[model samples]
Target: MEQFYLHLLVLLVLSILLRFLIAPGHAPEEPPLVSSRIPFIGHLIGLARYGNRYYVRLSAQSQLPAITINIFRQKIYLIYSPGLLAAAQRHAKYISFEPFAALAIRRAAGIKGNGPIVSSSSEKGRSSFDKQMKDAVHSVLLGEAMVGITRASVAAIKKSVDDLRSTEVDLLTWCRHVLTMATTDSIYGPMNPYRNREAEAAIWEFDSGLGKLTLNFAQRFIAREAYQAREKLVKRLLEYFEKCGYINASSFVQRRLEVERKAGATLEDIARLETLMVLPLLSNSAPSTFWVLFDIFSRLDLLEEIRKEIVQNALQFKPCDDSMGKPKQMCTLNMNNIRDKCPLLVATWQETLRLRANTASVRFVSKDTKLNDTYLLKANSIVQTPANVLNVDPNIWGPDAHLYNPRRFLDTRASPGAGGDRKRDRKWNGFMTFGASPWTCPGRHFATAQILALVSLLVMKFDISPVAGDWVSPRINHRSMALAISIPAEGLMVNVVTRKEVKGIDWEFQMMEGKA
Candidate 1:
């Protein structure tokens, strides 16, 4: 009798454990597993060798809308179907992004584990550090809070363009430098640490080492140079704040300090957290701006059309600069008008993202969840919505999906056919580069405005030609594993001469600002 009771108790305990890790027997089935030929390590090798393309190629192996990839015995729901991706997003409360965010900061900052779950704001003042930081970040980077920074950045861009002189330059180097300077000057105010040469270089170095740092596995030895680079930038940032740099900073920086201080974070903690804020400003935005310029310039017809579009639709003229005693109209380009009115320019931007922005919207399933009543995701699963896969999926984008077709978005829609009801399934979830609602990038509005402004000015105010003598698309740097949008594998040399017509004429950027 004693033995029977003990056996029954053990069975009950095991059942409870299993229940948490899996769904109930009556629940929906988990996504179908796509077994690999080489078994356990095949997918790992594929990822290391092929980088992001591994997932794209893997889709050919299975017909599942979503596949269960076995990563070292852990279930990773690699969502391929737009419908499943939407469902996962809808059940965000259970398939959470917060835990992963907290983990990323914990690992990258070298902080001791302080619990990996970022509490929901619904709990309000109970505020875990990550939750507080998220709230503070959203306060200024999203909605109406973005106008001040947008205005300042536009002014900076206008000044940079006005100073442009004919010169031979590397396109990537120029884009990174110009965009970083313009963006940081606006957000960091007068004491912007990135203005210092060492601090400027350090941001890129830290970013290069970010992949290893976020893995948090003996990163000091493996990514020594990058680790030191981060420390150097952190030191400069610490000095910036100690000297009351926040006094003149953008609301984004101000809110960051206010929230972290309230959470009793140390100065170092605040600096480290701010490091993440400075990331997209320098990292993603520059490459995106570079691609847009490269694409427009490579096709002269497109360049002229973009220039014409801006001139016709976005430009406003006022008699402000009559310095030469010859009447001159100072042209003001309304960047918001460029964003809204120029369909071709907007389409070009979207095409570049679809083709080159390789990223996955990753989440952690903290509780058993049903995705649109069709699929069940168990707790302990990792969910990844790979935009790289969906962006080029033939089913969603049609037969010519692999090619860059800006016309696809001229109607403000994807090429259609993402499965199921097809009409309703073709929603915003199909575009995952900036991700979907709730987890959508907070800085996207500013980034878009900045990129469009830079492209608009370059095409309109200057005559740029490749030093190679014609337009040749450089191959992407495939080995840049840590980055989402890869940079050019080779240098693109260009001659930039201010157009004769625009010389000596003052031009200003009229930025349209509202909700982010």
Candidate 2:
């Protein structure tokens, strides 16, 4: 009897082990609509190689409006139909991002607390970040913020121009530094680390590890080093804060302390604030600036049009000599003036952004929900609005969707598809460069203004073009192993020359005429 019992036990143990090895539990309860067989791994073989195209293929293959994907041991439901996806986005309260493992988030940001924004509905504060964090960021927006920011940004632009006067600098490489200076100065003020290249490098090193949720062995190894780098920088920031009288109870530190007192959050919370302040100001601004310059460098016809506008506007902004024979800071053009007059300048940028932006928007489902007849997403599903797919749709954007056409935006009245108001359009199919919903990027207006300023400055000052016959635009490179949320393909490398060198340049040259 004992021998027989042992034999049965061995069989049971082997069965359990086999199940685990096969990862049967990892399988989705609802099998994906679109199925593929590439041995042990499913679509992963193609996914790793092709990235976005893999999803595009799955969308095409599924035949259904939505498709299910098994990736990273999770069941992902991708909604391909723009109309259906938009409906899902409208009712986004049902889905949630809380299903993501804490370990995955920690691996990305090197810190915890369900990210900087804690939702009230969540048991562990795993609610949507669109409301809380985004609100906090835009809370301090004011005309005063613009004044300092514009001044610093303009100063940085002038400095970069001076530095690159004799050199054939990569516009993207140097413009990032200029943006870093402007943004950091505006946020951190006196303790700005713009001049400290080492500090800037460290910050980027730490930022690199953010946004991946996978914690596989290789990922963990990279995360370990990233965490170390994060710790080093966090320590430095803390020390800097202390040196700025934080330890001695200055206003800034005291304000933070007061928040801790009210909310009972810890020193970790303060650290989070530091990270939030730094990142929001750095990442997007740099890329936006780079793309504007890249567009100008690659397209000479577009560049000349923008140049003409800038020179005209610059001439208008050139103040008549005051009684003291001093030029005023600005020539009195306001926001309304900018919108009404320089449509081409504005349209060119909008067109470029549409071409380069990854998608329309992304929203985390706040609860488990169903969209349409097909998808039954679990509580914490990530439902992305297929902006890239929609933006390039031949049916919606017409046959010329792939071509770069600034006139599309310039002649909105003549546009067959001016669409509708943002919300209504978003409900169907719309552009999502700044996302949608309450969590839409608050700094988008500011970002647009700054990018326009940078572009205007470059156009006014430089004659930019691609490197001769080698001037073909660089293919957007998104296939790198980097897992950051807003990863941009490597920027287009191009050459820029001063406006004077161009043979048939059109410019009023207001700044040159009266240098105080």
Candidate 3:
């Protein structure tokens, strides 16, 4: 019996060796493949160690424009070259984002089966379901609709800031609470699912569990909490729709629902998808706001500079008649003025995004295609463009790329051309904070406006300082896989006091035309 078992083990080892020996090699024109110590599982181990930073590490090692990572039977091509990325994006039909987007929607939104919710059908070869949805989102985030939403969001933010009676608070927690309330209220009106604190807590719970859910893990084993939270939020959303709660919602919310319904999505699917929408609208923005505050406050010079800019651009004081024998000062911030006039603030925002954003833009190769006239991306392969790689590339961003320099964006100079005429172009490029090409985020304008409004309000009305003697930036919590923006590992505790300059003043925010 022992001899028989030894013989069987020997045969198994021989068979595995033979299989590897007989495997086909990459074509001469294809990108070089990184060899693994153990077939199939080695790359997985590497990914586990590196997470989203895996591609950049690989790129640095290989110094290749593209590289193929084979895990089991799947192939993922990482495109590091800007030229190759542009080509891949331009060839939309052959290498598409929709298929991957559909899969993400199903996994993240908890939609069952391969539904028509993500399907594409061309009428006169014109519009697909994905295209229509994109168009709807774009339309709703522009002009009057955007203004109305921004106005509502600013109001919520103002109320939250004004009601801060406590001397000490956690910065991240405060930003999350205020930003979440503002974002949801603006989008969903009075029937916002996140309006309830329990429901809001559930949303965060669901977010923390996305990794298990995405892997299709068993709820009985690991994802029970996430599953329960998702179910609760979905039920609330479905109830809201059933009761016509969308009647008073923003056009963005109403139009999104209309588009989904027209695409033949059931109420249950819509509810699940709405839960997914909440992440992008709230999760990322809150952390981003926190980071913006941290960066500014950590450096006293930067904070003072920003405050001066805001005062010069957005802040205005109107003398009000007082009935209590004292004159009152009413302060109003025009968001339009802030957005247009505050170059340093805008630069700071951009720098923060570049430094902190770790989102990777992913797409599916629909057909066999050549990238950069070299690497052949086989059909059904995954491709990724990690924004961090682009944002930190020294060749593109100069020698000080890794440093957080807000003035990096402000140094645009036009060189002298023939006949002493100034050149039209600027040298700095490769800023992909919100992504690029067709897959760029549609809600970027609204998010930028919302964040700026909140940050501007906080700086103008409140004095904030760390409770601890000195400010130390917290390590990023990479464990929160559901969030695209990097979350701090811990909450920042700070003392907040109303700015004496803005005391006895009523604060208001207005969305001016042609601003965002």
Name the best candidate (by lDDT): 3
lDDT of 3: 0.78
RMSD of each: 7.6, 7.5, 4.0
Per-residue error (Å), model 3, residue 111: 2.4
Error of 2 at 301 (Å): 1.8
Runs of candidate 3 with Cα error greater than 4 angstroms are 1-25, 113-115, 118-127, 322-326, 412-429
Better of 1 and 3 by TM-score: 3
Mark the regions of model 1 whose C-alpha exceeds 4 Å error after superposition.
Answer: 1-28, 112-127, 322-327, 413-427, 479-482, 512-516
**lDDT per model, in order?**
0.77, 0.54, 0.78
Per-residue lDDT value at 492 in model 3: 80
Better of 2 and 3 by TM-score: 3
Please report how far candidate 1 places residue 194 from its true position, in Å: 1.2
Q: Which number leads on TM-score?
A: 3
Error of 1 at 428 (Å): 3.4
Candidate order (TM-score): 3, 1, 2
Worst 10 residues of 1 by lDDT: 113-122
State every prediction's TM-score relative to the real structure. 0.87, 0.74, 0.89
Encode model 2's per-residue lDDT on 341-458: one tens digit a residue: 6788787777666676654243455566666644566644456554555555555556797888877675452322355454334322545566555435556656665666667756
Candidate 1, 1-516: lDDT as tens digits: 999999999988885575445432222388777766654566778877777777777787786688777755567788898878767768878887776666677667665533222223433443355666678778777757678888888778777777778999898877878888888999999999889678878888888778789877778898887888888878888999899998999888888788777666677767776776788766888778778887888887888888888889999868864656787768888877897788899999988887886777678999988787777888988898778888887777778988977887786443344445453346345777787766788888888888888888888888888987978889876555656576676788899988898876678787644632
Q: What does candidate 3's lDDT look like per residue over 113-231, in tens digits?
A: 64567443433222466677777788877556787788788888889888986399989888888888898999999988779888988888888787788777575467888889989
Clash count, predicted structure 3: 0
Please give the RMSD of candidate 3 to the true structure: 4.0
